[model samples]
Target: MTEKRSPWRAIVLVSTISSYIVGGTVGGVFLGLWLGNQFGAKPFFLITFLLFGLATGFYGVYRAIEPFIGDEKKR
Candidate 1:
């Protein structure tokens, strides 16, 4: 038998995932801007850190969902 999951859990998970991605991306952009200004290399740092942030965000999403994936597999 499959157990029913709570709707609140889903809502919380979605919220967490969104926050992780948005926070990482936004934080990266801000940091990149600051660093670029400090080092006088705007374009390079901005692009690099933007990509880094995206990667970090995706990694975070994967990590966050890993437990749920494992639970599904066990069932």
Candidate 2:
């Protein structure tokens, strides 16, 4: 069986993926900055959280896309 893909699907997927990565990174940076400032250890926490964010963001993308992948596999 063949599946028909919508043009908007690509747009939405790209947007959602970008949002996942960007949102996680930006949110983490801000939160880390705030916490670092509170703790008086700016760079350390900021760097750590930024890496954490990167990991979380990619993991989120994988999770978000996993169902689609499963569907394709079943087909």
- Per-candidate local distance difference test: 0.88, 0.84
RMSD of each: 2.2, 2.4
Candidate number with greatest lDDT = 1
Question: In candidate 1, what are the lDDT values of residues 14-61, reduced to their tens digit?
Answer: 998998899889988998999999999999999889889989998999
Model 1, residue 37: displacement in angstroms? 0.5
- For model 1, give the 10-residue run with minimal summed lDDT: 1-10
Local accuracy of candidate 2 as per-residue lDDT tens digits, 1-75: 233377777687788889889988998899889999999999998998988898888998998787678565665
lDDT of 2 at 29: 97
Candidate 1, superposed: residue stretches over 4 Å from native: 1-4
Residue 68 lDDT in model 2? Answer: 73
What are the clashing pairs of model 2?
none
